[model samples]
Target: MKTILIPVDFSDTNTNAIKYAADMGCDMPVKKIILLKSYYTSVYEQILPSPDFLLISADDIENERQKIEVQLKELMKKLKNRCHENIEIETVVSTEPIVRAIHNVVEDQHPDLMIVGGDMGHELSMIGEQIIEIAKSSPVKVLVIPPDCNYHKIEQALVPCDLEAVARLGVLKGLNTSHSWLNPKLMLLYVDPKKKHIGREAEFEASVKQLVNCYECKLHYSEDKNIVRGILNFATEQQVQLIIALPGKHSFFYNLTHSSITEALSLNARHPVLILK
Candidate 1:
């Protein structure tokens, strides 16, 4: 049974992500759906100069906590009803920093995949940072659903590979698990560095073929001048719905700072990009 972790903050975007997950899980053998909510205590209020802080009793905090709990239960019920199935929905409430809380949950739950809503603006919110941090730290795959994305049709997926990382069973499992929703046409695109000789084409083909055997999806390969350009061009030509890529381990910090190839593709391509660690 595949487990999917979705962090919720009661925002409409997060709610949409929950709906998307349920819709996708309908045809898959999902074991559990985790909805995590993190709340911070009023440490800032305590430090504030306002004397009104003394007027608020401990009961006020407890009451707020209870309210959030009830809200989560109601949200779970609504989700179950919407999915029309008793997809196991679990909720966690934490006061830790959102990023730390997410990291802790991923560490403990070990979910197969994570789905989060992306912020459309230029600035990253707490939720956005949590999503990005989880994507970087998570051992599994992460999918950030854009605000207006249509989740029903993820038929064509483009995966750009440098063929550096050794493709493992865990990575293959992530791709196969997505097949339930996507039924994707997999494209393994490689960008030939300008200085390298074109004769290495045979070696690249053999490597890609080995990776292709790991899944049953249709595979295509292309050698382009630029990695990002190749991904965008192919996705545009094929009209793909998602792009999957392995983020390189080297210069992890740099990748996160600069818009990654996957990130760039997500912005420019006609589809979403799933970045797997």
Candidate 2:
């Protein structure tokens, strides 16, 4: 993990993500933390222009930049002091849309990860979906932190395995490769259908076991129809602090309701969800 680019709207809601990034930087090889603020003229501001609306000059833009810079600096200071060790802190204030701004940041910084604060209890709001869409498309990993959940030691985390992708792509193989995973004990949840099909269950389970054998892992199987809810239930029951998911490729799980399950779990996560791509 070299760089983490965090896009903030300068709202109090996202402060948690900012702090979370700082906490992560403490132990990881996180070299840089870029705090970005994307701003634009609002609809109300356009309709009710300032005193010199018609003759708006460069001064207005500079003033806005300075304001955002000040805010970013404050956040930068807070994060810098939070960590016991030193890491680079940068502040970027952009006038582009939030989503586009994020892409631009990623293009420029090439961050290893992106983190954002998410709301709880319902499906992703419009803005949340846009943040998630960026995650879905980004080659880098994206970690979505829930609003109410505080950052603590990640003791145990859950990983849902359909036993297909992990076999073909070795997605789970890279689980411990990243320093950010913190080597938490992993729980692999496999929810099989109540009605069995004549597939290679034994072979699949064997493959799954081989990948997880190096790390402490517990295997689980569920017969629930709603796989998304089933996974979330297990997460809550086990008191897991994290869930790791990879972006989709055409596989058995993807064909069997990919968007619905992945979107629901990532967007409406009760625990912090890390989307590894």
Candidate 3:
């Protein structure tokens, strides 16, 4: 049984992600699906000289919260009806900030993965920022589905590993879990730093082979001057549909929260990228 956390704002994008997950669950094992909604009081609006705030009391907030819960219940019911198997659903209401709310939920629940929806362009820049924050801080893996993407059987998964750190069993466990649904063709890509000698490439290949032997997948290596450019180029050339990345010990998150590898992949890559922590 696997637990997946999905944060919803009642947007079509988020709902689409929900549908994708529900459909994917048809071939996989999902124990519980967590639906989270974060609500905040409009402090700025309260300061305004308006009648709207005056008419609204604590009771009004409670009533609205109750309404949202009812709507969520109906949505979950619809999801269950459409899914291939029965899945437990849990709903949460929070008044904390969005970033904080997500962190708190993950800490308390410790879900196996977190799924989110992305909207491109300037209108969604702030939403993108929040998603990036979640990706950086989340202790588990995070999957961001683009708005225009149709849920296809994920047949090929491109994993761009630099071979800089020892692969962890936990990370491999999560990857295998995704395999249950997509049964994807795993490509372990290693982009060697341009300064390194050719001999070092052989050593890296051996390490990757040993790490991935337990899992069923193919492996490939390439030398490139830039890490991000190498990954994007390979993904485009191979027509890869999804990319998976494991945040290394000295990952971009160490220096800045928003500059994580997953964030970079989201901003640049054409395919969806899954960030496994």
Candidate 4:
């Protein structure tokens, strides 16, 4: 991975993700890190008056943008201390919506990865609430760092998947070519909730092995009524440092039955979850 894009909202959750990215970049072949902040004015903010109950002037908006730029630059300086001197860091302040701003950056720069924070509390920041949407829509891979997750050497990663959609494993081939720094052992987990797909385990293993030949991968089968719980339990037992989520018909996001469960997994996972497109 050569470049990483991170959108900052100045929340405690976002601050943690920024630090995590800085630390992770040191280990990867990362060359540049882009810090983006969106200053888009919502309809309510434009219509509602300030504390003085009067519409803010254009100068006030420019002043706010300047202040945000200063903060972004300060963050870049701190990240530089955490990264190797060779790594280049840049900042971008935009007036477009957060999603649109990210899309423009991706189109122009084609970053290898995007990192975001996952909020675990009910009081979610606007950016935090949109994390899943961003991951789903982003053309590049996205690594989500939970509020309490700390950076650690990624020695092993768990991939909970449906073997029927073996085509999705094709993306894993890039792990060796594009992100050689992330050479962690892989564990492909199949949660057979109803035990209906019993005899096809070996067949699926053969298919998965064919696709992920570049890495050390092992296939595992689990039995549980709740797929989310099953995946979490196995991850805890194996002590994996990351969870690889594939998006497709049998994707991680699809398996998550409800918004609440999705939030629970994304926001509470002890290890970071990498959503691959």
Give the winner by TM-score: 4
lDDT of 3 by residue, 18-84 (tens): 8877876775788788888877667654355456445545676788889888888988888888776
Reference-based lDDT, residue 189, model 3? 75
Top candidate, metric lDDT: 4
* Native-to-model Cα distance after best TM-score fit, residue 154 in candidate 4, in Å: 1.4
Better of 1 and 3 by TM-score: 3
TM-score of each: 0.78, 0.80, 0.79, 0.93
User: Which tens-of-lDDT digit does each residue in 153-230 have in candidate 4?
Assistant: 899999988887888888888877866768889999988877756888778878988999888999998988777778
In model 1, the worst 10-residue window by lDDT is 249-258
Off by over 4 Å in 2: 40-60, 121-129, 178-181, 195-201, 249-269
Tens digits of per-residue lDDT for model 2, 219-275: 677777877777788888999988876457533223345357445645454688887
Give the clashing pairs for model 2: none
Q: Candidate 1's error at 205, in angstroms?
A: 0.8
Candidate 1 deviant stretches above 4 angstroms: 42-45, 49-60, 122-125, 164-170, 177-183, 192-197, 216-230, 250-270
Of candidates 4 and 3, the better by TM-score: 4
Better of 2 and 4 by lDDT: 4
Error of 1 at 62 (Å): 3.0
Error of 4 at 169 (Å): 1.1
lDDT (C-alpha, whole model) for all candidates: 0.65, 0.70, 0.69, 0.84
